[model samples]
Target: GGGWCSSDETCTYRLTNGLGSSKYYNETVFFGEIKSTNKTVNPDFYNWNRIVVEYCDSSSFMGKANHPKIISRGAQIFYAVMEELLEKGMASAKN
Candidate 1:
């Protein structure tokens, strides 16, 4: 277990294990949509963000893009969409 403290509160943490890559899952979905359009897609969609939610066990799900709480890791899911976005240059520094 791990512990952390903030100006407001202290919290305890433990690791949770899960399967598959949430980042790859979300990226695949987004790229799939883009490829489906034969690369004639709008740039607006590229700016839009996506998330992959890790459900019970090793299961995963995708929620709406740019919406709040689209992804839930619970300290389990291995990949994070935000990290992927930054690495892929899909999101800007201002974002």
Candidate 2:
């Protein structure tokens, strides 16, 4: 499982990590331009899989979503890194 998150030659304004707009842990990131990110992409993005994102309002976590990921080239790279982590964890579990 591998994914990648990168901007195409056209992107020259901002940066971000994942897909599907702005999903965050505390608050939904709907505003501001994404400058940079450390969140890696999970292979689940390239293929079929499930993803859960914490959605909240101005107060707290309101709910969650179980859906597939739709990301850009940059976000895809991040997804790939996430895939590597998952694989490593799985392998370690067997050992």
Candidate 3:
């Protein structure tokens, strides 16, 4: 009725944060490996949902006395994994 999927289940994800405070020129890097336990369904079903990675910075030369700037990065590998699952026709699109 409201959200797409219920929280009745949990997913496992491995991630890396390579954006190691490159304040000299504002640089960031990250990657993740995600897997779901709902083996009954295919990975392609999670296409609509995404893992949003956010970054914040404040109390800096530019962020001084201001709210931390926020940026969101989306998942990349998930879709590729999903595409592969769909090829087998075992995956379905989810809202």
Candidate 4:
């Protein structure tokens, strides 16, 4: 089966494009459900401050490749994001 980038060649291609990088990301994005601003639609989580972590590593947040060309640090990214969130009130969240 084909994956996002099966080989170094394809991964290199992804690295240059928007798939493995965030250089072409938009400044704003809107999500539904928990991240939604509509209280009627989101109900429980509408008023909570939300963040949308961009998936730019192309490794499903589980890779830690030490390649010379491609810097696949998905695990590090996940932990860093979690730490930041914890520092920013998530440590006190009941749910």
Candidate 5:
């Protein structure tokens, strides 16, 4: 229900429920980074769950595989997280 955005474009966001306190809590974070260019266009996105998907293919977009390949671990991880979120009902916008 709460979040923060980075002021610098190169900086990444880290989520925490508490700040300026003596205690620290451990939790998983999603979409921790919002590139500077993206932030400039949608500052309000800081308030929402932000996912920065990376393309691991070494070649140009056209050279990329059309389907999920074994080497596409990044995509696999992303989908796994999405599935888990959906299963837990945490992916809902109402949350």
Candidate 6:
């Protein structure tokens, strides 16, 4: 996961990893544990569909950034994701 950055200097450093930008992201990721489909390992959620939000903003999905070179929009990403999920049936999800 991408760790948080508290200052411009640190956030600038984040550019070198997936935590800071998609340029460094992997094309695919492995999902395990609660995200697993193996009934033996995740009995209750074995059949559930899941989505993985990569930790990129480094703000714990709480804040935005004003740096000219850094694009930080954690809050916006969170709301947009929620909106899309709701529209796609999450609004009526039972679990």
**Candidate of highest TM-score:** 6
Candidate 6 accuracy as TM-score: 0.88
- Candidate 1 lDDT over 1-95, as tens digits, reads 12222212121111222232233233333345643433356444655545544332222322222213123333332346456666887555554
* Best candidate according to lDDT: 6
Ten contiguous residues minimizing lDDT sum, candidate 2: 54-63
What TM-score would you give candidate 5 relative to the actual structure?
Answer: 0.28
Which tens-of-lDDT digit does each residue in 24-78 have in candidate 5?
4335444434532356555856566545323322221122224332121335555
Cα error, residue 72 of model 4, in Å, equals 0.7
Sort order, TM-score high to low: 6, 4, 5, 1, 2, 3
**lDDT: which is higher, 2 or 4?**
4
- Minimum summed lDDT over a 10-residue window in model 5 is located at 8-17
Candidate number with the higher lDDT (1 or 6)? 6
Mind giving the per-residue lDDT tens digits that candidate 2 earns over 10-74?
Answer: 12122232222343133433322232232234332333333333221111222132213322333
TM-score, per-candidate, Cα-based: 0.23, 0.21, 0.20, 0.80, 0.28, 0.88
Looking at model 4, report the run of 10 residues with the lowest lDDT sum: 1-10
Pairs that collide in candidate 6 are none
| Residue 75 of model 5, lDDT score | 50
Stretches of model 2 off by over 4 angstroms after superposition: 1-10, 13-72, 90-95
Q: What is the lDDT of residue 71 in candidate 3?
A: 20
For each candidate, the alpha-carbon lDDT, in order, equals 0.35, 0.32, 0.31, 0.79, 0.38, 0.84
Candidate 4: tens digits of C-alpha lDDT, residues 1-95 = 12457688988888665577788667878778778889899998888787888764777777888888988888999999999999998999985
The residue-level lDDT of candidate 2 at 26 comes to 36
Candidate 6 structure quality by residue, lDDT tens digits, 3-93 = 6898889998888878787898889987788888999989999999898787848888887766788777889999999999999999999
Q: Whole-model lDDT, candidate 3?
A: 0.31
Count of residue pairs whose backbone atoms collide, per candidate: 0, 16, 0, 0, 1, 0
